[model samples]
Target: MNEPLAQRLRPKTLADVCGQQHLLAEGQVFRRTIESGRIPNMIFYGPSGTGKTTVARIIAENSGMTLHKLNGTSCGTGDIKAVLKDIGTLAGAGGILLYLDEIQYLNKKQQQSLLECIEDGSVTLIASTTENPYFYIYNALLSRCTVFEFKPLSAADVERGIRNALKKLSASEPQPVTMDEDACAYLAESAGGDLRKALGCLDFVVTAAPVDEGEKHVTLGMVQQVTRRTAMRYDRDGDDHYDIVSAYQKSMRGSDPNAALHYLARLLEAGDLPSACRRLMVCACEDVGLAYPQIIPIVKAAVDAANMVGLPEARLPLADAVILVATSPKSNSAHDAINAAIADVQAGRTGPIPRQLQNKHFDGEDAAVKGQNYKYAHDFENHWVEQQYLPDVLKDVKYYTFGDNRTEQAARAYWAKIKGEDKL
Candidate 1:
């Protein structure tokens, strides 16, 4: 069987790895540690194709440890035990390096089974996970391992990998395989930081390209044909989902329409219409509250339209909502007020409801006394009256502070006029 181009071009040394200069750059602590050949128990956390497995393999080779590869998706406690059984054999004499890929798939008990081996120095572990380690990892097991996050490769980094792959492919081909510069760039950019994906696309296009005058030519059209859509690394249940949603809301709250739309595009591209709709409604209320109170119902209509229409049409209403919220005058006064009131209530600072504010419907002997002094504000001028609505203990506490927006300031002026306060 033919080996995959990505596997054939896997980096054998740290110098050959495509990206992650943050961890593997010369003079860096991680690089220095790997060169020192005293590899520690560590976790490789990142998206796929960022060279975690490659780096782990390089470390094992340099350290002269007996590398034992196991994927958590396929390996269980019994498989772990099988590796442990070789602990005293000559095969394990140099120490065992267990490279557990997708370590998040292993349950707590399965993870616990390795604690003894790791603690005793019988096994040096390098676990890799695409998910956030803190959320999925067994805390005890996680504590024993140092985590190194691998970031997505930049277009330049991926382009380097593509160039290398082309060289290797050309050397093996009967006719020299060459790609247009634009094609190479397009392939690298479309891979979305996944070297494996870029290489795979390259492999397919090169194999399918026709030889012209003893030279195989890959054009920009060929690259486009192979990659109909750009690769996006988005897991609805994972970090990407939350991160994009957070960026979407924050961009609107920060009043950057372009950034808000960009994140909205990401969410929509991921087919996460529900999250986009939900967050837009939240941004309208939490970030644009009071300053644009009418926007609350307007965003609700957009959200309702989005859900009813669904994507590709869903993005239309959603984008309108995102822009409206992003461009609206911003305020968090209402959100802050509710949060402060909730905090006080949760902190047990709530005193009893005042007698006048209590329910007045009861027929008991004290029923008339319960709500006796409650003044009818409508009967008074300005449809307002001086009243203590908050519990006596919190009456002096100010929760709602008017935001400095025009709408809020106008309301502030009106209330101040009605209440006869000098300050607006």
Candidate 2:
């Protein structure tokens, strides 16, 4: 009778679990994996509030295996060995399903320690990570587990989950939480494909006990009142933290604002601090660059705001920065140019620096050695410079392909006009 709302609302069967259409569809490999009954060692990778734990539970309970659960944060090698000793001799009747929640929290040695046990069939792992396993989990241990990537639960699933939770709550208490269609969508939107967050929200809504069960229906306003979250557990200092940022950057580069925002929001909501916001400043300038100069200043402002006022208050500025960067025009000419220059260096494209830039301010002879061939931009009427910046081996090589857009076109045209005197 004292069951938590989340537990009461948890999916009782695989059918009850939401999202993962790729895995849940009929005849799918994941579906087959589930029906296989003898579950293999697996790694479940995804963000928090997603269904990683839920799916692992389904796997354990549904399998004919005996369940053994441990938090990786608290678990040590001794605990693992004890579990392994039991598992090494476990019979078919005593099949073991070991669920390691937040397995990424365990250090490298701890992860590697389980490698032998898993390989020897001493333990069947169901390790869960809110980050990419390849980065957090040891390659040895990861190789032993069948990696299954879990996606966020959809809004529809969140809605269905809410309705079912209301039904279950009604079973215990005479009254249940009520919500209208738009209210449901709003809750789901706030949840952002996280069933746990949705159910936790529903639980909060019910606890609030809106007395007016009459035509005064549950609306988005009520849902917003109930679910005011400002923190997430994902640590920003770690590698996984950068991984999400990278995903957000690439997503923006790939022109997917939805995905970029999703990743960006996850980082900020997870308590990703000012430093991450600072990194975004470079990303905006270097990646968006001249293509969307607006992003540069906005990102700088966001970083300054975060530094001046820290989080959870800092999240607003961070979110604003992400939205600005994500929505801005994107180009990778700077990135490409750097890579091309590096390629030239590797390919023996060695030459002295152009004369104009050769430490003109410095008095030494070789100081200008690096800037030997540089031309003066202020010499021409338009203050344009026409000279070879690259060494002889790389002189003919051109990097920095412009994006086919208004901003890039203007930039390329200016670059061409400035450097056109090299027709010789």
| lDDT per residue (tens digit) for residues 117-156 in model 2 | 6787656789898877887888888878899888767778
**Model 1 misplaced regions, further than 4 Å:** 360-371
Q: Return the lDDT, model 1, position 218.
A: 96
Model 1 agreement with the true structure over 1-424: per-residue lDDT tens digits = 8888999889899999999999989999999998888889999999888899899888877788888889999998999998898797999999999989999999999999999999999999999999999999999999999999999999999999999988988899899999999999999988989899899899898889999999899999999997766667788989878889999999999999999999999888888888888899899999999999999999999999988988899988888888899999999999999999999989999988887777764546755454358887999999999999988888899999999999999999988888889553
TM-score against truth, every candidate: 0.94, 0.71
lDDT winner:
1
Per-model RMSD to reference: 2.0, 6.0
For model 2, what is the alpha-carbon lDDT of residue 151?
76
RMSD in Å for candidate 2, one decimal?
6.0
- Which residue segments of model 2 deviate by more than 4 Å? 87-93, 174-177, 180-182, 210-221, 228-284, 287-334, 346-424
> Counting only residues 3 or more apart in sequence or on different chains, how many pairs clash (N, Cα, C under 3 Å) in candidate 1?
0
lDDT of candidate 2? Answer: 0.74
Candidate 1 similarity to native, TM-score:
0.94
